[model samples]
Target chain A: MPGEHSSKQYDTDLETIRSKVLAMGGLVENQFQDAISCFRTGNVAQAEQVIKADENVNNLEVSLDDACSHLIVKRQPAANDLRTVMATIKVITDLERIGDESTKIARAAKSITERGVTTINHYETIRVMSISASNMLHDALDAFARLDGKQAIRLIAQDELVDHEFRSIMRTLITFMMEDPRTISGALDTLWVAKAIERIGDHAKNIAEYVIYIVEGKDIRHTDYAASQLEDRTTN
Target chain B: MPGEHSSKQYDTDLETIRSKVLAMGGLVENQFQDAISCFRTGNVAQAEQVIKADENVNNLEVSLDDACSHLIVKRQPAANDLRTVMATIKVITDLERIGDESTKIARAAKSITERGVTTINHYETIRVMSISASNMLHDALDAFARLDGKQAIRLIAQDELVDHEFRSIMRTLITFMMEDPRTISGALDTLWVAKAIERIGDHAKNIAEYVIYIVEGKDIRHTDYAASQLEDRTTN
Candidate 1:
């Protein structure tokens, strides 16, 4: 309790930076949702808006990263505090990458709009998958903010669903291309959009993994343990 | 000269970490090269080898990240030293992602081999584009290792050529799918491989941008100015 006043200030600083990361996460989620809506509704203006908003999302990443670094240098907090700062840095990086994938989705949406979205009517699959990926991203951010390693592990399980949807979309598109050669161009466009969405899920999973690293001090990427070992470990 | 000796030790610590990062880069480059060769030569064995090597690459990432956090906490490095550590963190993240992309390429290679690799004869464009992207990654690591901002800018310019190659491959595949429905499945397989290669270039470009950020303290990502401002800045 001797350092009580400064400790309170440190907590406030950490909370403020975490809030900034959540803000960036919210922006990226919007970009992804709007990109999907553009592809679904053939709204060229929305697609263009999403593309322009990506710059703002990127700027947020740069600033938030600098904030995390400044926090480390100024506070020089040891152990858990240092891990928290490092995790925040990694989370913002994933958020920025999710924004980049959203831009790709927007670009593909614009192309599909130009070609007419009628024949390329597989937007339903994209819609479902994007909603799932967007939600994963949302929960991943929540997991990071709350430091709930349990919830983070659950999101990792959900990424497999996204991957399954991606393969399903690919199969449907390939069949469409084979049936009508005229749909090849539009199918390819839609495929690109789906691919972007799939990548968003991967980024979200990465954010969740970072959360577990913060909460549990375990790096579970490139492995299945996170999604598997969720039962008795909480008691430990 | 009072802090000269300690400062020299700090420089050595920085160099040692940078050397580890470059070693990781070399390993990822080998994974990418072997992945492409696996696809080109229809060698399932080599493809499996590349896939297995991805785990080692991932392990290296986790260990290197821990090392970086230790450096920051122990050194309490400020200003340029802090930036170097941060940049190294970012560079390794990109390299790990490149390893993931290489795993995708190797998986696609294995799939192509199982499919007899005969009808998916678009290997030439993939080979060309992959070589361009691989060289970009190599130079990006060199830029990071040498702290060469100018060379980093050059690598960014070269990424455009890889993009061009990707677009060319896309066009050719779309035509192939349209002209003969029989090739639709094969075309899709090849497209996935092309996409993984295209993404390798992108991750490489991100590494280059980080190089510029470290050397010039400017974030030039999602911008064209880095590649354009080389000539006049030498005097500055």
Candidate 2:
């Protein structure tokens, strides 16, 4: 009776934790969107909202951590189940960091708005990069929810595109800086936002790696594209 | 007899894991040093060495992961012993990421060196920032080795210095861009190096958090300067 009772309780607890992780992920995703929108249109109020709402994201991280430890101590779930829980714990951390990056962007946006610095020609590149990175986030989370390795792999491939956009943005900023030194502050702020978007892309890649780990028990970390090619050749 | 044999094996395995973590820490420290040197003088050979030596760091990470899993499964170490092993597992990931950041710096240095870019004046700032970040790494790892929350707390406080330095560097780059748009490419490279160093400071802060977790039953992830305040409160 004790065994049966405890097993049921663990199942319920895990479901709750999963729901909470998803909720936190949604909150983080929204924060990114809000933060980017504020930067795009110079919406100071929206940027302020993003900065103020960071506490919610921070609190979610703590709760998620507590749930992870409780599950580990109580259920001691094994293999794929263990991997899933571990992935949840790790992704929550990446999400929390993403939240922080978004806050950084929002703060930058607020500063730019207050200074009445409206000559933002390079932000178009930042906007495009933001959208691309956001798509990576969506795909990574979708893969996680479905436990699909192929989707995760595709998401990882998208990361390079974001990197390209980030580099182009840097080039544009450099050009701007060369034109007028007074534009330096705005350019640097744009650089921070671009960097934030790049970090979001990195976190997306991290989630994709976890997806592969959970699905295939493959430690794809530090592994090159050639490893897969070699595996394909050997199997064939 | 099984219990006695298990105890001896556990002790041996734990000792091996401890040694492996220290070795990994040493490799990471070396990479950071080489990366800074590469940045300082465009040392392409040194940068290549740092890049090529990344494999050793990866190997250490995998070995540590395997050892942690094996120990947890076999010994089922409880309380402080379990916390110690978990901390080791967690800190290695942070160390490996630090190594990755160093690689990034090396790459940036090599790229600029390839372009034969000059006229950068913030070289001193970059040097100072790298040293400050490396010092933070040393302090954080020392705190881990000694399980000293007080030391970890102080090391994390020092992260603010790195942040402040990064801001000043950004301002310098902005000024360069504003004065002459032609200086954009070199300034961007400089910005990337500054960012890589700031990221190292962040990883050091993360290691400090892990150390605090190991020494005290606390989660200081989202808490504001909680680790530093802990010692003062306890003393009073």
Provide backbone clash counts, one per model: 0, 7
| Model 2 interface CAPRI class | acceptable
Clashing pairs in 2: A177-B177, A178-B180, A178-B181, A179-B181, A180-B178, A181-B178, A181-B179
lDDT of 2 at A78: 49
Native A-B interface contacts kept, per candidate: 0.71, 0.45
lDDT of 1 by residue, A105-137 (tens): 888878877866575566786778988998999
lDDT tens digits by residue: candidate 2, B72-131: 656755554666666677788899999999999889889888888866745686878888
- Index of the highest-DockQ prediction: 1
Q: What is candidate 2's CA lDDT for residue A39? A: 88
- Best lDDT among the predictions, by candidate number: 1
Give the DockQ (2 decimals) of all models.
0.74, 0.45
